[model samples]
Structures are given as C-alpha cells and as structure tokens.
Target: MSASQAAEVVRMGVLGHVPPMSYRNAQGEFVGYSVDMARAVCQDLGWTCQWVPTSLATVADELKQGQLDVAAMSLLSTPERRSHMLFARPYYTSISAWVARPGVALEAPGTRVAVVQGSAQARFAQSRQWTLVEVKTHTELAQQLAQGRVDGLLAPMMTVVGLMAAQPLQSLQLQVQPRRDPELTGAASFGISPMRPELKPLIDGALERLERNGVYDKINSRYLPFKVN
Candidate 1:
C-alpha cells in the first residue's frame, strides 16, 4: 500500500478505565492509557483515529463485522480469540488477584470467588480451583462484594488496587501470587481484526517504540493506585 493508504484513518475500539487511557472524567470525557497510546500512533502517522466503546463480550463480533479496525481494550489471548482475530505484542501485564472484603480470608477450596463471565479472571479462578460465580463486569463483582453475595472477587491486581483507592472500601482487599502456569497470568494485549492485517504492524510498531521509551511505564504509574496493604 502507498504511504497515504497506510495513513488512512482507523476506528479503534476502547473501554472506559482509569486516567491516562479511557476514563470518564468529572466532565465526562473518556481518556487514559489506551486512548493516549492510540492517539500517539495516529499523530505519528497523521491518521484520524476514532474511539468506539465496547464490552469485552461484543468486541469480537464488532471486529468480525468490520465495524472496528482494531480493539485497544485489554483481553487475554486464548486459542478461541486467536482463531478469530490477531493480537499485538503485549503492552501491559495485569497481575491477576483474588479480592475480598476486609477480614474475610480467601482459601482455595472453600472460598467463593466472583468473576466476570468470559474474562481472564474467571478462567484463572477455574484453574486455581476456586468456586466461581460468574458476573458480567468488574463493577458487578465489586457490588457483590459490597452486598455479601460472594466471599471475594478475582480480577487484575492493578484493577483491585485502583478500585480500593478510588472507592476506599474498607472491606475490599487483594491477594496476588506468582501465576503457577505462567501462561495463565492474563496479561493484556491489543486485539486486531484479521481483515486489517496492515493496521497490525503500524499499531504494534508504535506500541513497541512507546514501551522502549518509557511512555508505558509513565502511563501505568499515573493510573496505578498506590496501596499500603
């Protein structure tokens, strides 16, 4: 393809999260790491990038329909996902964790862990032998924890930390250990549509450059909530 064709605008889907990516500010603007990273790539290529909000369950369908060129949201690379879409080299590693209300200890066999259905955390919980109660979203799991619907929740350690900081839940706590299988760590990578093979290299190269230059570290630091426990 010519340089102009390569620089054509792409519609990148994203999800709302903490600042420096796709967070909804008090003014209600969506911004954060994924957004900044996507924006940087667009600026470098002089391309116009559009952000589409989507849930994890529907991203694959959207990509398949060609409604999206790429997905900036984080999803684990499973054989199932690989069959339908391509993934960029990992941009961030989210430590999977078991979170619970303060004072409730989480044990392998006896603990009831709430997880988002079809999420990495849910899969990890299954592998770890936790009794799983599948919910729809991280926020929903948090609600269950608040309501005593379950013993604890499993999710990315960073997300647990961020939630604790932003919500200041005295009951919520997180436990993280090195993943035993290594492959189950559930680190995040960008998902690309198979139809847009060209966009993969363009976006992946920009991500590689950003990681090498410490841009990603800075972005993570800004969003990661510091926890004492």
Candidate 2:
C-alpha cells in the first residue's frame, strides 16, 4: 500500500482477551462484541481496520504515543485517561466485581487480589489496599485465581462471568461478589488516540449510524445475554 493510503488505515487495538467483549477464536482471529462493533464502524467509515493486539496495561500509552489510532476494547473514561486520550460516545455501561473460591473473605486487609494491570479494577484494588497480583491478560487472570495463587480476582462483572463459562475455569467453583465502585462503574467507550483527534467525529458518527440501523443490537445479541448500552 502507498504511504498515504496506509496512513489512512485505522490502527485499531483490541485487547488480547476479555471474553465476550474481546478475544481470539479457535481460528486465531479476533472475534467478539467489541471487535464486531469496531469492524462495523470501520465498514461504515469505509476505512480499513488494521487490528493491533494490545493489553489493558499498555493501551493508553500506545494511544498517547500514536502507536494505535483507536482502542476497540471497552474502557472506562476516567480523569487520568482523559488527560492522555479522547473517548468516543459511550456504547455500554460496566460494573466491577470480585470473584473468589468459597469461604474467602475479600474484605480482609492485604487480601491478595489478581487484576489486569493498569485497569480500573487494579486501581480500585489498590485503593482498598489489597495486595495486588497484576496480570497482563484475561487468561492469566483466570489462571491466577484458579491456581489459588491469589485470594481473589477483581475485574468487570461481564468479564468474570465470561471467564467462568470458558475452559480452564468452567470447572472451578467460585463465588462472585458484584459491587459498584464509583470509579469502576460507568459508561464505557472506545479510546481514540490524541494523535488522531480528527477521527473522533467520524467514529462517533459511525457508531451512531450502526446503532440506528440495528447493527449494534444484532452484534450485542450474538455475544451478550443482555443489552449493555
């Protein structure tokens, strides 16, 4: 592709794995709710969607540095993130939760809690002074909890549910404690890099059009049990 043509391609980043939200299929292709939404948006805009695999720990930095044009993973728009990247119109609402093996007290001081590094869940765990066991991906998050390496896992409610339904974790007996933290519960949006501020309106329009045309609902029904927006 020519340099200018390539420059016009959207470098959209997808989180390594977050189940129904974002994850790779058996065929090693990214296929999930967020991915579908991003693809639809790209189609609407007539732009090529160049999927860039990323993790929650580094998405913000990648956007700030112009390494990514947009992050397709659903992200909570917090003050800290707003300082570095622009957020598009919210597409869904999310809440945080804690999961653990039966009889474990998550409220206890210094309880070891596994979280995806640089995520809102991590920040909430740190705020509660929990001993943080940071991981980079959803698979690691599940493994850390299933192996008993951590006393508990803190993450978004949907993510925890999706993890429990998937392999290497479906057989494990765990208790979920859904709690809404001000910082972690709110509207979730796609992250737009500051380097491409001009794409904001174009993406927002695409999302709106998708929602209006019923494409968004179809994608949501394919993945989630209920509506998120």
lDDT leader: 2
In angstroms, the error of model 1 at 53 is: 1.1
Compute the lDDT for candidate 2.
0.88
Model 1 root mean square deviation, Cα atoms: 3.7
Candidate 1 clashes between residue pairs 3 or more apart in a chain or in different chains = 20-32, 20-33, 21-31, 21-32, 21-33, 22-31, 22-32, 101-171, 102-171
Q: State how far residue 69 of model 2 sits from its true place (Å).
A: 0.5
| lDDT for model 1 | 0.68
Q: Quote each prediction's TM-score.
A: 0.81, 0.94
Candidate 2 local lDDT, residue 102: 91
Candidate 1's C-alpha runs over 4 A off are 1-7, 17-21, 102-107, 126-131, 168-183, 225-229
Candidate 1's displacement at residue 198, Å, is 0.8
TM-score attained by model 2: 0.94
- Kindly give the stretch of ten consecutive residues in candidate 2 with the minimal lDDT sum: 1-10
Residue-wise C-alpha lDDT for candidate 1, range 148-178, written one tens digit per residue: 7788877666556555555534444544443
